[model samples]
Target: MAPHLGDWRGRYRGAAIAVVRPASTAEVAAVVRACAEAGVPMVPQGGNTSLCGAATPGPDALSVVISLSRLKRVRAIDAANNTITAEAGCVLQTLQEAAAQAGRLFPLSLAAEGSCQIGGNLSTNAGGVQVLRYGNARELTLGLEVVLASGEVWDGLRGLRKDNTGYDLKHLFIGAEGTLGIITAAVLKLFPLPRATATAWLAIASPAVAVRLLGDLQASFGSLLTACELISDLALGLVRKHLPGSSPTLSPSSWHLLIEVSGGDDAQAGQQALEAFLAEALENGTVNDAVLAQSNEQARRLWALRENIGEAQKIEGLSIKHDVSVPISRIAEFVERADRQLAQAFPDIRIVTFGHIGDGNLHYNQSKAEAGDNAAFIAAQSAVNRIVHDLVHQLGGSISAEHGIGQLKREELLRYKSPVEIEMMRAIKRTFDPQGLMNPGKLL
Candidate 1:
């Protein structure tokens, strides 16, 4: 077994026959081929930052972990084509900086960008803060180079904007979560870097008000409104308690919105536009108290408050987490209904809600107020999930938003997905991995 497998959360531990670090695509293929011949299952892992436990394998499972960290490299950059081809193990932040150095922007800015690898991002089809302007990892990817379960490398690394070729094979592996193939390298689309930026922190009366304000801001700023995140009072409290130097932005409120607008090099003009929009929003009762960031450092501090939510929650205690998404218009109703039902069932529960509201996704997590009884609260996860997921399904929302269905949500996927859809996914799995030796017992 592998001597050491770094567990990101220390929640799941796995042992493998061996950990193989392949320096190149050919070496990765050879390792897979050898495993295939030996009838051994294989788990392809990158930065090992998966929150869904997708990268963690069971101790009893006979498998080999293929670590792609050694394959880190920036293969090619095409400024004319506005694309960069990078190997699987390239850190997301490094790729972003590389794009910036080339006078372009790769706008997949996640909280874990510093440690997460591009391969894991593509495998999970990660969504980040900028998803409101730029789409998820799938949308940013123009092409991919994957090593299949059968040791076959499919090189569809074309940097074309419009490729109407027979079948778009790249899409199959982007969000496959390592079930179909191992993403070795990819060609990702890049955009012109924004020169000017404006950010605001607004206090809202409720989630409904936040949703209405979002619509107003979108109508006014249009494409310039890059991000609009919603945070609840409970969520902010955790940050204030756990995160150092974190203070409330405005009067304590039920909800807060972190809005940002960016475009060409005219910081003054951007700030004026944002100020004008916020002024009108306040007058129209769309927002209550708002603070516009005067400088980049202030803007970053405000963002730190939003980004440190998960970390703070982890420090607090064990909690039940739900990463869900619904239609933008239905977000207000979803939050209201979910909170009402959960409160009714578990009256003593303390709910902390926040996330990318512009993208209609929320991290609706709950923890016991008294830390000593966390075990009892965690033991009710299945029931809590049912209550939340059922409401999400009723609202035409997804049970899992950015976090893919790993072993954590496999049964939930079956419960939520249509039989026909599940059957089709199974068929695809059989087609690509007939022996089910690639990341077996995951995402099915």
Candidate 2:
């Protein structure tokens, strides 16, 4: 209970009377039933790696924490079906490895994949770099096995890809953040393993150029463009400073794009295509400078530059973080306008910006430029949030893109969502958990 009381960010501390580890869905249902019958609240926890405190119990000590770690297992893999059934406690990286072992690809990826659980990934509908090619968790999931509030296990672990049944019940629980039920197991969609891959690091002029390059690459490469990330110069500097051996492959510039293309066919042709496209981009001044990875090791190093942004920022200092998105067409406008607006509002603030721009998501963070106590500056979170979120809203964007509306963004959800939409969500919550025992104080 003590260990399960805190979230990954240490931003939330909770209290639970007991932390129960269930080995199977039946055991989970039994525990849930007993807790509900005893009038005790419950919080379903996965890897405890949630950034928004979704897995952490509330401050009240009345709830019981149900840890799904003991249920880890890869139930089945149907390569022909292109789906894998995994238990709730399966670590995301292990699933990815299992898919690779079976010569397939499970593409729900992020920094926390090493520690985050499959259930949490589905629960949050997490988005990642490959979202440009492979959709988010919700799209990749084919079926779900969940335990309802009353301990009834809804065995939805079907691998059929074209089951146009009545209502899609899996969706209600996938992104519900445990507000509806406990996600016990899931059947996730997988793709053919990429046999050939090419990666590049490019220095670009601005966000507008990055957007133009993205459109051009999409037009040229189509589905081969698996990932396209945008990084600011300051974000790269933080990586170089905090992560040893993290050197830029390309010359320093104001902004950078870490682009990748993958194909299951010939490696040489894929490499040639990517290089030819880059040559054209460079010739047209669309790319100021670029470096292409000649080997797998170099590709990994190039990816580390983009993948290490979160950890780099963490080492730098406490910062206000926003996982947001706008329409792809409006991404450049959003960045330019948000930068100007935030610069005017908070002078001398270090803005660390980077994310999967291929899909219009951005991990925009801010902190005091100088390394000192930012407690006072952190106190202005609401102001900072209002400025950023308001702009996102006006541009028809989402405040929480990959991360769900856990306890961290509940208030923001209320502010951004319409009354009718909020009411619909509340109605669904009531229909699913009438007793309100499932993950209280989350999402809603």
Candidate of highest lDDT: 2
Candidate 1, 401: how far from true, in Å? Answer: 0.9
Alpha-carbon runs more than 4 Å astray in model 2: 371-373
Report the C-alpha displacement of residue 127, candidate 1, in angstroms: 0.5
Model 2, 269-351: lDDT tens digits are: 99999999999989988999999889999999988888888888888778998999999889889888888998898888788
What lDDT does each candidate get? 0.89, 0.91
Task: State the lDDT of candidate 1 residue by residue for 346-396, as single tens digits.
Answer: 878899999999999899998888867777888989999999999999989
Candidate 1, superposed: residue stretches over 4 Å from native = 1-7, 246-248
Best by TM-score: 2
Task: Please provide TM-scores, in order, for all candidate models, with all chains considered together.
Answer: 0.98, 0.98
